[model samples]
Target chain A: MYENLPALKKPRVAVFELASCAGCQLQILNLEDELVDVLQLIEFAYFKEAMSNTSEDYDLALIEGAVTRASDEQKLLEIREKAAIVGTIGSCAYPVGIPGLKNSGDVEAASELVYGAKAALFPSVPVKPVDAVIDVDFHVLGCPIEKDEFLHTLTALLIGKKPPIPPYSVCVECRMKENVCAFDRGETCLGAVTRAGCGALCPTYGSRCYGCRGPADDPNEPSLEALLEKRGKTPEQIAADYALYNGYREGTAGRREAPDG
Target chain B: MFDRVIGKSDLTDSLDNLAERYRVVAPVSEGTRYRFAEIDGARDLDEGYIPTALPPTKYLRPPRENLITFAWDDEIQVEPVFDQSDFILFGVRPCDLHAIRLLDEIFDREKDDGHYQARRLGASIIGVECLEPCDEHCFCHAMGTLEAAAGFDLLLTDAGDGYYVRVGTDKGRQLLTELSGAREAVYEDRRRLRKIHARRDQAFEPRLDVEGSQIPALLADSNDSLLWDVLGEKCLSCGACTNACPTCFCFDVLDDLGLDLKSGTRYRTWDSCQLEEFAMVGTGESFRQPRDMRVKHRFNHKGRYLVERYGMPGCVGCGRCGRDCLVGIDPIGVFNQLKGQPVERR
Candidate 1:
């Protein structure tokens, strides 16, 4: 038998969060069966929600959630500094996400609904994704995130390779899935403009994609906007729809910076 | 080829006889759409059904098929796997039937596909004539694929009380022996089928601006057609059109390993030209860079390239691509615009 060389060091991975729901972080855990195999290949360093033994020294940093508050920005910078590889998970950390939709008008009213008069306690600004606040070495994009994609990103870093990025819009994925057209059903879809990789999930179930995965590699918003208009959609309605996850790229998120915590 | 007057009861018997010998596939409704699926009896047949969302070619070239199997433990070993089954594709519309013929040209080129040829030769085709246009979207008449004279073992024409069966191959002739009550088609039955076809011809008013013969020339001159940009801006590039398209046979190959890692398989999965990375090579160069260019290529391939290469039509006018485009960038509308013919303004 070969002498047991000091066990090959497993790549240290840390999962971090900022100013949004931990949906993206949840996707890693969602890979129930594959999670065990993934765990064997990597060492968990700073996943506070899952592990108590945390470490700053890590190989890869998987950052989730949008950078809305000032405090979240400071924490993200610290995490980015410590990790060798800083990769973002989900739209929240990429360019824009559902949290970015709050960049629209009537924030005081919207905040009041949730925080009441305590809204003053949490003084906030427009939501911007993690990339706006810091550099992201790689991105695993989606609203909640797709599990296999998360694994792909990890494996790519493990082998020092770039993950295969989704090239086209969800319209192509919708076609591949061979679902009936949502437009023909008299419904306007953002699939023609949004990035694929979610495998046209909404459309597969007979619903139009709301751009939950952010803008595709090449998004023709002008053409998409006009098509929506032809379908009797107003400019404001189209803006709001894209704002749901793609407010930054859709050009609906105005000139506002991160929230003051 | 021979003719037989198969009565309604006799036709069912003939189908059952064929079904006994081969795995019979026919159209069946799934919610609002229709698809070709395995049938155990005539009751499973969707008579006068629309063109299925997926074509009979799925049986020949599956969405995913294992091309090779590799086992590596003591030594590396590889073996080619050619999987095929004897099937009778029943109730095939002429448009779909014509698609099979186009595929024959593609697979039987200089590099013959052993996998596709295995299925193609093993399977028998039974075509059902379209007595009328399927819907307002169909342009099979304009595309000249409404009736196929060959590419099928048998052709079935509806005649109310019975079916006028025309056998096109010896395989079809052999099946006739099992048909209990088939008789010689008299002059009256043949005359009725002609009348049905004549009526069908009148119903299919050519929607495309150019005639079927003029398509190759029209496409050559229409390279600068504004229609390509118009369609491109609207395309999702999702590959649904090509995926659902009857004639699209492009595929991607990948290696898959077993959990144990001692054995693995090489498989071919369906690929679409509409995808942005379809033509992208390892060096990071994409030949079809833009959506408009891809759209232009799709139309050109259908209208010009295949015609010039094979001396046959590229599209069979099945309408599945257009039906699933979501943006309404279907061929019938695009072709009219290519020839500078104005679409009927709504």
Candidate 2:
């Protein structure tokens, strides 16, 4: 199918990871059926997850994970310099993701809790999204990266078309499914402000959205905060909810004032 | 109108017989809520149900429907897709019947929506009248959608010992004549129907501050009202309200390419104007960028715009939007405020 789509020269594509669980890269591998078609569209210059081959020369770089260390930042800068286009592959690479939760508390203290006695050996910096250090051509956002969105973005890039990313909130998709609102069940959910494009997967399966894909464009955080407050969510509970993927953004985890309206 | 009477017990058997000929969809209980789902028999039907979570309109305009499928090998080939499934929408409320008529008017206008028109042509509507208000959120009485005169093949009203069935068309008359247990309405049955109607009229109270005729005028030229900002502050812009509405038929079309990339299906999914990107152009210039503006537009579209365009009420006062809204934003509160009337909570 890709053979008929524009008939362009195969670009050298590379996949790189920084300080993530390698889930985003695994999503590429999880493209089991589409992977065959994808392999035919581009030449892999460097993808440690799938191939042993590595090269500095690449036309496109898909980087995943947050930059948590000085070394991670250095590697990202090098990739940005060499690659013609750099796109963040997941919420981790785009919004600092779960790794950014360290920003809500003392970085050293959190590292010591996990890597005690070796905390000094693994000195970590405040988690920053890939765009914080380098320019990002585009983003494929989700927790591990929705495989369909990743493929869609890649296909659009190959054809020189702007990737279609849904700007609406997850509630749009949630309502299409006609699922009972998570709030109706006395549960505070982030679906109201979270980005769509995952087909409202979490809420469809009877789980509240934790904002794994980050905030939608022009997210009504204040309105959501007020709604959560009405549902008896404490300030700490609301902060913890947002801290998962949005802690990197200033005031996102701390803003708990009553809606002025 | 061909008037007939069917006993409550006989109605079940009639519905069972009807299901054999068509896919009969009726309201069924789902946990604490109710939804309009396909039923095999009357056993699966919830006779006493409030407005369903989704209206019977879903059967006509599905949430996601494929518009066309495209394939390119040597040459690009495209084929339009239309839903051809013939089904009977049973147990539809009077408000929803009005909503369906509004959709029919919209889709069957100058530029006919082929998909909607196809489904509508094959679909049969069997409406059930509501004697009482479903909930505090319902304002069908005020909106003048509680009593539907046409748009239905058969209209059923609950009588004391039986159901009063009013046949509106040849299809409805044929259904009544073909059915086993239905008799011509006599003087006693007519008297009972009259008594039921008298009781029904008193059961429902007007829930609007202004008359239904004045709504369009009130909403006209009030585009820049501050009330939108006040409502927007509380509104999450989640679009639950619009999605649950019976008449909100906006959609966004997208292509889903096959793995091979040459073949794809161009599908339309239910979209909402409440979303921030609903009015965004290719150049990134959003007409209704602010949530307040988007919020105002939806109310105007429901009250003024559709009435001005279609000569019919856009909102049927089903109250699904109000009940489904995470924040308790309803038309009753907004309309009362616009009319300078004190907001009353039922």
Candidate 3:
């Protein structure tokens, strides 16, 4: 899709990070078969995860992790200025990841819990999605990016076609695979309310969905809560589950306090 | 008006006769719910039935589909698979028919999806207009899908004594012509069809009063609404809504290896965006980390982004989300709440 596009002409691609585990970058590396093809397609101007060399001007920039510190604040601005298309690679870049849960509690208290007296070494402020700092052209959602999806997005970029993102929830895929109800197994699965694109991997492996990819398009949260209640989960329990990852973002956990009633 | 009329009692014989010539799929009672399944005989057709367990789209777009077949070797030959068969979809609800139209807009537009297009092009749609609402969870009226506008080969209206058939496409006309007892739709039949639609409209209480066009604007304005944060706290992100939705069609491709590890088939399966790992990368970073943002993204995509990009609302108002929700988070309720309406708690 990018074959004839002017953007593809000597395309400069960059990969950057913030306060994160760098798992998303590892995922890109995991795309072993497609990595060489992608490398041949564009100029890998900046990638701290893969190489030592770096550059400022990039046509496309892939960002990982949330903005949690002063350095992240500066690094994100630099990336925004250098890259024309800035795409977020994981939940941290979009919803602040698990560290975002600190938004509810005292940042200093949480910092102390993690770093003790050296809490000053780590920024105690709450984390935010990459879009909170600069605009994002696209998003490849998941705890760790799906290797095929990474390749698919790159292929779309190469061919000049927009990569397709699953718009539905995990439940849809689960039903397609004919998996037994997670609730029937005495476990609360978020597959129904969660987004697809992970191919229902967690549920397939006997684990419930964690909303790692994010919510489905047009998520019915109240109804999901009621279903969870019917399956013997309390609103508090549901709230706790939601608070696990990127739940602390004001958009997610912050709204849990207010009931539909 | 034609003098010859058939009895509701004789409907079985008509269906049985039709089944001998073509594969007929109709609504059948399955446990507590109804599903559109193949009917070997007329007995399999459940006349007094509600909505199916899944939409008839399953026949059009199967759960797992083969996009292409490739042999693992230096010669990477790709062959597209198209499952186009001569089948008849009997007793499809008007809302489902409309849903098919929406699917056609997606799969049959621009660079057409050959697999979906082949099935759609070959298969025949026989619609059954609703005389009453499926259940309280249905909001087809709100979405203006209560009536079948088009996208069907044949439209069947239950008119007490017998079904009033309205031939839509050429295939429908040809099918009716083959039937010995079929006749032209009369004035009374048309009148009864209108009456059935009127009663159906009356049966469905308006669940959402917001205009369809205004949904994009409402979503844009409410991007930072407190409702998102409130619901995000409650959301488990199980992804039932997308699975139950008639229009949601995101999928993932996988290469299943054989025991020899030399050959594998690439299969595309349905995928959801609700799971935590969906947007995550290998570097242990998640983009849509906050449940609130994830929840908000889902709503915005369905209500705003899709319409902006595709010129259509992602939701068909099927209420599957409401029915399947573990927390009872109805999108209509959210929209109503966003619109400042009183939403009584379940």
Candidate 4:
């Protein structure tokens, strides 16, 4: 699949962000070792963080945050119009993430509380993932994108192949690592319903999974609820865990349909 | 004259001596569980450890293995990678030894897997008899894997003060010669070993309702059974069950490119059928979309498919899958339910 890479013209790529901590954009720099060689494979048409040069011409636009304003949606639509493929890079971009916590309560109240008098000037809308506003070709999922997953997605895009995403839950990798189940350790964990490919990062290091990568392919919410209940977690606690990173997702947002390919 | 008995201290000394020349992998304690790891001597060995989370097959067919590496400039050059480093797989329980035997049959079938073959050829197995059932999750007695008759170089039986070492091959006899305390089994030693064997037979009572031979037909006929749905509901599809299973040998191969993009390695990592994507085809159609179908496939493969193909039981009843599963999905419980028998607890 990669054999055709040398023959194809270097694709122009751009990076854009909105309503995020910019931690996801910083993950691009974490590709320290491959950055030099990666530059050889693609041209950065418009990346304000890494390069000053900006261009309207780009083959792909890698967006890295949630759309929380009307202006953000307009910018996304423009990127969708110009780019052949529009991909979201982090939980903020794909699932609306931590910012989506306010979605369950009053968004305007929360906005005013944060910005005070300046809130009216910067007006905040309900947080929505990039896919909610524009057509997204793919998603590199995580709180801040997993660097390896980012590289894999970039390589797949460059090679004209679909980026392979594992459709299993975090529990698979956790169990494979032979780590004691977080629930078994008396900690309520969302690894069972959360998407894998982060190598069960939190659980491996003695912490519970927060589901920052979004829901797994066929997440059985009822099963997860029952599992948590058996571990003495109340309904409110379970909802609280879900709200931390996946509040914006509807019951079946991350669940894949047969035609999703 | 070489002895056929290796005392507890003698075994340790023999292991320490072997460590000088070869990699000796044995079961060692890791936190609350046991895992197969390279040990400098028998001191690191967990002599009475239960079945490890992963079987000794890990050493033969590792979770991630490189098959070939390639580089290109003017022309592409591809070279195969083989792990032929000799190692000793020590402290293998009868169930795991049986698992290794089945893995041998699998990897040796149809175009013999070179990677597995290379590793297998360079490794030696030392089997240890389990005097009692490992835990409630184990049903090795019903599975007929309580004691192994072959597929190991040396067999160790706990004979109170010393170990009764039965040599299975020339390699075993050669290994015995390295131990200074090894001596021919006397009349008393033989009598004691027989008594221990008799007591061991009594300790491992059957946990399954039906015979191991009857599992294939029961599972094959239960294609539309609702038990699968019940299992699917409980199954997280996390693949912990398959990864912990002693006999699962599925793998997915992928090519990893170097920074230069001119060089790369094609590697195969352990894959599980429980994963949703395992059955997905290139055109985006998944054959087993529902979780129940995938759950049923695992039991069918272990109970029916492997039996028909190789005439040997696929699941060795080591109970690692049952013990390691977060949802407590045990094969013995599932099989008994299919047999219209109550779940037995001892």
Candidate 5:
């Protein structure tokens, strides 16, 4: 149904990477059934991670990773200039990903931790999501985006239709499958408070959700926190759980207070 | 017109007489709390009780509902599932009735949610006004949802001996006609109804100090307030509030495969926004990264954004969220905190 995508005109699609593991791009390749269809829709103009091509101008640009170095900043701006619709594909591209954990720490300490003796050789600045540099039209969430969502979003964009954004929490899906509640099972889960996109995979597999997707449209945090506390989780434990994926976002750690005597 | 004066002991016979033809659902004691379930006999009805563990909305909009089913490989085929049941939601509280009204505004606006509309159309609401306050947690008075008004088909007010039924629609009138025990209201019955309403009004004291209309403006101005950071710090992002809220109706749709991956049903289930992944897209970018932003987004949506967009506050002041919250993060308390006023906690 999605046939008249603007990408078909120029058909030049570039996938770039900076400081990420390129796992998100691999996820794009993992759209097994629709991979060939996606390939036909766009020309692989510049994908250093997947292919061995380097073209200047592109119709659609899918960037993965955070801007960590001076060279990476220049490259991202260049990519934004060439592509009409820039889609950021992962936590690294949108919110600095796991690497953003260092944002709270000093550059020197981070450098020391990573480079050790070659501390001076590594980039000194903290990493930032791609949108901080250039405008990103769309974002694909998850540590590694789901295959169906990737293909569906690409297809929707190809046909000039806005992709549907899910507005529910992970708990909704968990209950749908009739799975035992994570809290009842003695494991704290971010499912209730986390956005509903990953189809509640972690909870389904007998693991607590780590909030790989992102936040929902409207989240009920107070109740969720209370539920966790009742289940025996400490305040620090709750803060630590949210800090995993959302450390950069100021409220992710919740309210900070001065220590009382 | 004669005053209806059936003995209190004959309440069950009167209800059983009505149940012979129409499907009846009433409040029944389930564990520590009461719950609304189908009643084959009048004994299932809990006349004087607390609010049900879950609202009657479950009977209308189930937790998991089938949206559309698809079959691929050769030709993409799809079938949309629509609600096709005719049932009665008996003994709904006024707050829940108000909740249904709020839901009607959402599901019936613009595109029209066929699933919700279908279920709503076939169902009838029989409201029972609370003789006494449900509990310390209930704040329906502050939200102005304590009295049954326009949403229900019928409203039943308990008089000394029998119920003074106010028929709100033709269906309600027809249903009441089926109950042979019911008679036309006399002067005394009308006077008693007024007394019951007045007593109920005086009984439910305003629990929260904030004005309902000003909540939107308060939230809009407090967007960047440090309270979010403070609230965020304590928040575990567990999502109990959203789940407990009668008005929080956001959902997620997914395809489930049963052994043979080809044949699966696409079902839509209730989803909360408090979790970290609610706003995450396929590419891994999270729109609301911090717990603070996520928590704030929720309050704003319920208190301000939805009202701005749909002209209605998302909260019905049921107090389920407050009762269920572990850290005592009540919405009223949060609102009061935003206004820089001392909170009146139950």
Candidate 6:
């Protein structure tokens, strides 16, 4: 598809946001070392957080955050229509995130509690991931999105290649870093089934994985849940931890595996 | 029985000599555990260490090793990239040394993984004898891997004042010949080694539940055993066990593209079979989807499948799989489960 374009023309890139902590956008700005080299090679046509200049026509759109209201879905579909490729950055945009946790209960009523009297004029929908509303081309899975991974994804996307996504659980990276398991130290962790990409940052620093990244591709959630139960976690607590990031993800996620220890 | 002795000072001198010709790698302390890394000098080597967090196999096949790089424009261009570091892997434990042999066979047995063969050929191994078991997690004596009979260039035994060296191959002999102070071993050196051996036998415990020879037969009928279900309940299915395992060589191949939109690399990274997608096909049908089945396949692969196909059990009893396990679903512990012991402790 890129063959039709001129040999040396740089691709146009657009970075957008919805309902997120804006941490993923900050990661793009944090590419201090390669930012100059990367800037010379591409057109960062629309990144409001870092640059003043903006453009409508883009070759790629990087969406961060979740679709919490009807307006967000409309804006995302319009962006999808304009861009050649669309991918989401951060857990908020993938399967789900903290915002998506609102999907389980009354989001409209809760919005009143959080947003107050303004809820009368503005309408809302159940909080969910972007893909549930529109087709997403790729997912950069993490809480804020890791810097190295974002760069890797951008490099692949510019080359018209899909970046390699990890389907394995977080345990792979944790073991690689040689971090002692939280379970061994008498703490509960969701790392066994959480997706890798954050470099086991929490476990390496002596904190348990709260599953800030969503469930890994084909996670054995039931297995992890059962193991948690044996470790004395109640089913409600297991559901709460599992639902923290990816509670609104598709299918019966918790039904798959029955072991996590 | 090719024995020689080196004054403790000369051993460091020989390691310095090795550093001149090759990149020397050894287990170095990382707070509570040891990890394999490149050594600037022999002084960095941890003389007293446990099985490293990851096996020395990382030197043979790295976690994110590139297989080839390619560019596509008017024409497709491909170039195979081989890891070309000629290095020395020193101080690998007997269990891990045996694991290197296991990988050597697996990568070269059929299609010949050129990438692995290149790294394996580039490096020479120098092993250190475990006079006493490294810790309670070790069961190398039961697996017959307490001492590496071969697969090493030089083997060292720590005597009171100096190191007793056994040269196994041409590479070892060359290192010995280069060093000036290595003397022919005296009879007392042999007597000292035997005494250390006798004392160590009493120190190591929780031996292999069944004889190593009985593994193939015992696991053959384990499909119907209740062990898989019991294991599935405790196994977090996190895949920590396989990643730390020395003989578990399952890997996944991936393509990574650079921003040039034209050039990218194909990488073969370490993968674990315990993950659900390991056996999944394009149609999304997985042969080993259930946790119980995945748990069962790993043990059978270590104890039965590799044995049936290669006439040797895949496990080298490094105990990394057990010691690093957050849930303690270690190979020996599982074997004990099969033995009707069902014990769980360090």
**What TM-score do all the candidates reach, one by one?**
0.87, 0.93, 0.60, 0.93, 0.59, 0.85
Best candidate according to DockQ: 2
Query: Which segments of model 4 are wrong by more than 4 Å?
Result: A1-8, A250-259, B1-3, B341-346
* Residue-wise C-alpha lDDT for candidate 6, range A39-106, written one tens digit per residue: 86678889988889999989878899988789998999899898777778998887678886776667
Cα error, residue B194 of model 6, in Å, equals 3.5
Q: List all candidate RMSDs to the true structure.
A: 5.3, 4.1, 11.9, 3.3, 10.7, 4.9
Report chain A TM-scores, every model. 0.89, 0.91, 0.88, 0.92, 0.87, 0.89
Q: What is the interface RMSD of candidate 6, in Å?
A: 2.6
Summarize candidate 6's per-residue lDDT along B148-181 as a digit string, tens digits.
8777888888887888888888878876775558
DockQ ranking, best first? 2, 4, 6, 1, 3, 5
Residue B123 shift from truth in candidate 1, angstroms: 3.4
**lDDT (10s digit) by residue, model 3, range A134-167:** 7666778888878777766665555455565665
* lDDT-superior candidate, 5 or 6: 6
Q: What is each predicted model's overall lDDT from 0 to 1?
A: 0.77, 0.83, 0.72, 0.82, 0.71, 0.79
**Residue B246 accuracy (lDDT) in model 6:** 82
lDDT (Cα, tens digit) per residue for candidate 1, span A1-261: 011212224768888987668877777778888877777778888887687898878877888888777788888888878776677888877657877767775667767777998998887766778877776677788878887677655654554455645666887767655466687677989887777778788989978898877667666677777778988999889878878787665554553332110
The runs of at least 3 residues in candidate 2 whose Cα sits more than 4 Å from the true structure, single-residue gaps closed, are A1-8, A250-261, B221-224, B341-346
Q: Kindly report the fnat of each predicted structure, to 2 decimals.
A: 0.40, 0.62, 0.33, 0.45, 0.16, 0.57
How well is each residue in A209-235 modelled by candidate 2, as lDDT tens digits? 989777787688887898898889999
Clashing pairs in 2: A1-B260, A1-B262, A2-B260
The TM-score obtained by model 3 is 0.60
Minimal lDDT window, size 10, model 2 chain B: B337-346
Docking class of 1: acceptable
Candidate 4's docking class is medium
| DockQ category of candidate 3 | incorrect
A57: Cα error in model 2, Å: 2.9
